[model samples]
Target: MNHLDHGTEVNPIKSNTKSIITDHNKDDHNAQEVKAIVRGPIPAAAVPDHMWQAVIANDRAYDGQFFYGVTSTRIFCRPSCKSRPPKKEHVFIFQHAEQALQAEFRPCKRCKPTGVRLPEQEWIDIVKTYIDDHYASPVTLNTLADISHSSPYHLQRTFKRLMGISPNAYVQEVRIQHAKERLRGTKESIADIGAKVGMDNVSYFVTLFKQKTGMTPSAYRENKASNTMNDVCTPD
Candidate 1:
């Protein structure tokens, strides 16, 4: 009776097990389809022609559809970014913001494709800090823009608006301040000091120092020395 029971039930059990396995396989296939739809397109896939046209036209309708990165600037932007259009050859398309970033492209400060907006004051502060650190070198609007990940026009406008002076003026002020310190504390020649502060032309340096301080470097040094001596002699 035990042998008969085992033989009679084995086929039915095998049929039920196969049915369950088939259902699981169907569920897995459906899950993969859903994941593929959510992930959008593969980044390595060839860019569709319509995407390029959308970028050129600055089409806001396609903004979430794709992103384009400029190889020249290494910056990625949404289709709706209003900055100057990049050359066709320099642009690479990505299906998502994260894909562009993963490819080493920084999100555009203008469009902010990553949805994080850096505060204007904070951006200006970063520019100022860079200038302070590199004032002894030639700092131009283009160089600052490149380092700060912004356009030169925007950088100039924002920096001047917040700092009360243009970037070039700020650079001159920094250099002159350093020149003044060297003049009072060190015996370096005026020409050498000028060069050390990034103004290599002796004539131009003297002219600029007088313009900024209302006295030549030599006169300023002399005045400082005179004041120090008088203070020492009249000590309480």
Candidate 2:
């Protein structure tokens, strides 16, 4: 057989076929990439005006259709939640409760949007723990209610029903217990101790201390010192 010339030109048909096959492969790759993007998580739906209206109306008809989260409170609720309607700016719409939760919003205790209600006792315990940690700050019924994501009246009633006292009472109790600890452990003045425990009014602090412990702060401090001295002097 005669040898082919080294300068022989590439076949136009074969060259064109190779280019078409390469382009086809690229197109297939691009299509696959687009499909992967489409298969990624769908974004939450935007809140429409009607959704806001539904929320304002407390329309139970829209309950499972969507959930709304309040940015200020970081709480999500069903559309029918009886709690006050949040400002439109503070609201975010989520198609599913899981999406809201994933966005770091807690389910509303009152609305129970997660289909599971938080037990009253557990909710009160959470409130109580918050008080225990923040008792040095100004704690009020409305503050506790907001932090607990319940209406003030409902929180007051449920807290009392479950804990045997109002939220404010529990806050006072926590403050007083801390005051007692500081009284026993430190020589800080009674007024300073009261202020440290969130009771800035010395007279009120003294009176409330008396009401709770049957003695003024001064008396309590003195009593603690006397007991300490007695303990130090007594034989073990």
Candidate 3:
């Protein structure tokens, strides 16, 4: 029944309590955000000393994290480059290969700081060959980058640009093709067949097979068998 000048009744105690709760929630959220910012990854450029040590050690772990351009040679290299380390005073760290290139530094032929600078077809050929050779093994972007001597980011972009499909999708296609051949020619168990094709998880393999071929591996094998029988029975 009580009303203020604007003609609206208010509970002062409840209103005050809600304001306090809202302030407390805001404070808690801000504290969490501060903690997250503090715990975030430190960018490679912030730690030149650590990067220097990585380069000196030829640590593969630091390969794509940063590159060091040597003023003496005007060349940039990944931290894991096998070439001899440049003098510390003459080296400058760059967060990306483009940054070094912008500074007029050419990519080191040894470390290949600027990936895929070769002829586009040559780069694609190298990637495709690596994929074909390692189709039966576990091939991931990082592994492919290491094998192909490029950053995972650059390798993925280049591969998708030229191949019309992501590298992983290409690997899946290769695996499925191999699986089909094995299914038609061999009497191997389904799980064994999957493992032979680099899909160790049988269920995942079955799922992928069905997705790719519109039928399960068992069904595909049965269809092949039925076709073989029909061919044998036919006079032609």
Candidate 4:
């Protein structure tokens, strides 16, 4: 008994003609003709159900197999991206990293889906630079992510993890510090000083100032004024 390891077994054909179709016949040669098949990696459309579930679970095993992007946010990530999972309906699957890039989706900073890696501290430093430059303007998580090339979710997570403060809190601290400078150096009205430091609402500014420094903006200004006077009155 002989057993073949590969290739398909061909069936014998019984024809009405006088010739018999056997392994030695031309018909057997036609049956043995093999068609070459070239197969590439499976596309997203053909991804298995288990693979999709792995993405939801953030299983690292599927990291290189596929990528997913949130259509609403336009950000792509590896299967094991640490960021919170987007709604399934908004997720668009990619066969590979390049496919996500071709769709104009930014790679997630946390996952390094696009292979462009920036250190965690470097990202935090970029965010700090943005905060320092835009402290006087409106600052939001989205704005920080836009300037730092990261997702708002990732930015907030990394900023909190590394800096021990939320982005919004950091911005408020910067604004309050700027307000302090304006209050001490200039004789401007408290409201104007609040406005100068990006706090348009004077009441809110006063409340924040008191919460942070235990003194109202007016009290801080008066205290500075008194200290200046004492400096002039006292002997050098």
lDDT winner: 2
TM-score list, all predictions: 0.56, 0.61, 0.54, 0.53
Worst 10-residue lDDT window for candidate 4 reads 31-40
Runs of candidate 2 with Cα error greater than 4 angstroms are 1-106
> Highest TM-score among the candidates is held by which one?
2
Steric collisions counted per model: 0, 0, 0, 0
Give candidate 3's whole-model lDDT: 0.77
Q: What's the lDDT for residue 40 in model 4?
A: 29
Candidate 3: how many backbone clashes?
Answer: 0
| Candidate 3 ranges with C-alpha deviation above 4 Å | 1-116
Tell me the tens digit of each residue's lDDT in model 2 across 109-205.
9889998987777778767877888899998888888777788898899999988988888888989999999998998998899999999999999
Model 4, span 39-86: residue lDDT tens: 223334554566567677888765665677776556678878766766
Cα deviation at 20, candidate 4, in Å, is 44
Which scores greater on lDDT, model 1 or model 3?
1
Per residue, candidate 3 scores C-alpha lDDT tens digits across 48-74 of 465568778998765665677776555
Q: What is the C-alpha lDDT of each candidate?
A: 0.81, 0.81, 0.77, 0.75
> Which should have the higher TM-score, number 2 or number 3?
2
After best superposition, candidate 3 residue 98: deviation in angstroms? 28
lDDT of 1 by residue, 116-173 (tens): 8867886677678778888888889888887566789989999999999999999999
